[model samples]
Structures are given as C-alpha cells and as structure tokens.
Target chain A: MSGRSRSRQSSSVRISDEQITDLVHKLQQLLPEIRNRHSDKVSAAKVLQETCNYIRSLHREVDDLSERLSELLATSDTAQAAIIRSLLTQ
Target chain B: MANSKSAITLLNSTSSRLCFARTSATFASAPPDQLKRQSRRIKMAAYSSMARVAGRRRAWARALLFRLHTRPRHKTLMRRKRRPSTSSDDMVGKLRRLLPGGETMDVCTLLEETANYIHCLSTQVKVMKAISNHHLSKVN
Candidate 1:
C-alpha cells in the first residue's frame, strides 16, 4: 500500500504499462517508412532540377565549342567530320 | 396527344437538361458583341491570374508526367529526325523573317551559318579525337 500509493501520488499523470507499450510500438513501426517516402520525393525533385541545370550548361558549352571547332576544320579537312565542323561553324 | 406525351416524357426524364438548354438559348439570344466582350474579359482575367500563381516546377512536373506517359519517346524521335532538317531551314527562316522589309540578311545568314557550321565541325573533331584516343589506348 505504501509503495504503490507513494509512486502514484508522486506522479500526477500515470501511464499504464499497456498504454506505454502500444504508443511506443506504433511509433516505431510508422516513423521510418514515413521519413523514407517523404525524403525520396524531395530527393527526386532536387535531383531533377540539378540535372536540368547541368544539361543546359552542357548544351551551351557544346554549341560554343563545336562552333569553334567547325571554324578551325573548315580549311583543313572536307571529310564528313570536317563538313560537320564547317557546317556548324556556318 | 403525341406532342403532350413527348413533352411529359421529356419533363420526367430531363428537367435539368431542359433547364441548361433553356439557359444557354437565352444567353445565345443576347447580343453577340456583348457576350464576346464579357467572355474575352473572363478569359483574360483567368489567364493573368494563372500566370501569376503558376510556378516553374509545376510546368516541369507536367512535362515530366507527359513524357512518362503519352508520346514518351515520340518527341525524342521527332526531335532527332528534325535536327538536320531544321538547322538549315531554321537558319533560312530566322534570316527570312528578320529581313521582312526586302533588305538582304545574307551577310547575317552567312555569318550565323558559318558559326553554326564551325561548332558542328569542332564537335565532330572532338568525337573523332575521343574515338582515336580510345583506339590508341586499346592498341597500347
């Protein structure tokens, strides 16, 4: 009587053993799956934007570099390679 | 008697349809010019508000969804097929449109064309250089 009453009196809010177990167990089951799905979608959008920026930059560099190469090759070679180079230059 | 029967059938089956048709007919009976002006204002407001609220991400997402589902590789195939044809034609169109006043844009055309050509040539050289380097490495 003394131990039980003292413990109960010390804590105004009492959590039953079954209630504590159920709450912790349910939270343990749910949290990781929720974090993963949310993280995955955010990760996908970020990656997509990064890829677009990179591809666009690559395009500009390719166009600029190819134009220069075409000009360089125009006088030197008339092969398909050279023609492409010259064509791009034009 | 037949007319009354048909009217009764219509009334029982489609009071809502009749209402919609009646309402539309009333609007259609309005002055055409007034309806046109009101419709135009509504459309303009709708487009402007949509323009303000729409984010770039939504357009990208829509394009991604479209590419994933409908015409997935069709645009890519069309784009690939288009590349060569459009280059020359694009140059012509760009020049032709720019010089709409009958003045010659030949100089500009020749310049951009030459630039475009050089870029093409250089890219080819790089590709060839890359291939040859790979071959040389293999040989070694």
Candidate 2:
C-alpha cells in the first residue's frame, strides 16, 4: 500500500511539471521577440523575462496611441468623433 | 403626366433633388411619383449604412492580421547585469517582481498567470492599432 501511494504522489508531481512546461511553451509562442530565435537555447526563466518586457512595451504603446487618438478626435467632426468615443469607451 | 415626368427627372438626377423630393413629399399626401422617390431614398440609406458597417468590420480584421505579421518596432535588450545569480530561485524572484500580483504565487501559478497576462497585452495592442487606423483613415 505504501509503494502504491508513493507512486501516485510521484505521478502527480510529474503531471504538474508537464503543466509548467506546457504553459511555458505557450508563453514562448505568444512572444514575437522570442518566437523567432533558437527555441532550445531559451530557458523557461528567460521566456518569462522576455514576456515581462514585451507586456511593458505594449502597455506603453497603448497609452501613447490612446492619447494620439483623442487628440485627433478633438480636431475631427463631432458626430463621428462621438460615435468613435462611444465605441472605444466600451 | 407632368408630375410623372418630374419624378423621372428626380430619379435620374443627383442627391440634392432626391432630398428636395423627400422633404416635399413628407409634408403633403405624396403621389406615387413622390412615394417612389422617398422609398428609394430610404432603401439607399439603409444599404449604404450596412456597407459602411461591413467595411469597418473588414478593416478591423485586416488590422489584427497586420499585427500578427509585423514584429514590434522596439526590441528590448535584457540585461543580466544586476544580480548575475545563476540560481533558479533568483530568477524566479526577479520574474515575480516583474509580474503584477505575482509575489504570492507558486511556480505553477505564476506560469499560468504569465500566459494570461501575455494574451491580454497582445489583444490590447491589436485593439489600439485598430482604433488608430480607423481614425487616420477618416482624417486622410
């Protein structure tokens, strides 16, 4: 019985490890900067770092573009600008 | 007969006469000529609006496709100059700091959250680009 329980515990450990690797692989694919490189050379930790940096850059971009859009809308036709504003606020 | 001739002329002419006929038709009991013109204008308006909506949908899809194809302009260079600790624990600590609300998570949970965060950021980028393109196209 002890041997059987130990085997079960080890199987659960293996499963979690598999889950970690699977998620890491998904994160690697999502990152454009890392997707093109030698996949074997990148560690899981490296992928995480790249993802952090990429997300930061994307956030900055969203902020900048939103500011630009509002400035453009301020100058354009009010009717169309209002429509776009409603759509964006959603 | 004169009204019918005028109605035919209205149909052949441009939008100004169409508007004229519609306004005039609404105030009084419209003849078949005026009624035809009004119905035609209503149909055209609906059709044009539908086409505009479809065009916007196509433009958004194109924007997303363009995002997938183009690499981001800013490529960040990662520096290991800070800690240089080769331990996996040190790397995990740094990653936790990088991820939002990540300090309390275990390795598995952290990995899962990272994946979700990455997905959300990419979607945000796609949406921002679509909006910007829409406005620029309108202006130009």
Q: Which number leads on TM-score?
A: 2
Worst 10 residues of 2 chain B by lDDT: B46-55
- What fraction of the real A-B contacts shows up in model 1? 0.00
Candidate 2: tens digits of C-alpha lDDT, residues B42-67: 33322222223222223222223333
DockQ of each: 0.01, 0.16
Give one digit per residue, the lDDT tens place, for model 2 in A30-76. 89988977767889878877877786687566555545544444445
Q: What is the iRMSD in Å for candidate 2?
A: 17.2
User: Which portions of model 1 show Cα errors greater than 4 Å?
Assistant: A1-42, A75-90, B1-140
TM-score of each: 0.20, 0.49
The collision pairs in model 2 are none
Query: What is the two-chain DockQ of model 2?
Result: 0.16
Docking class of 1: incorrect
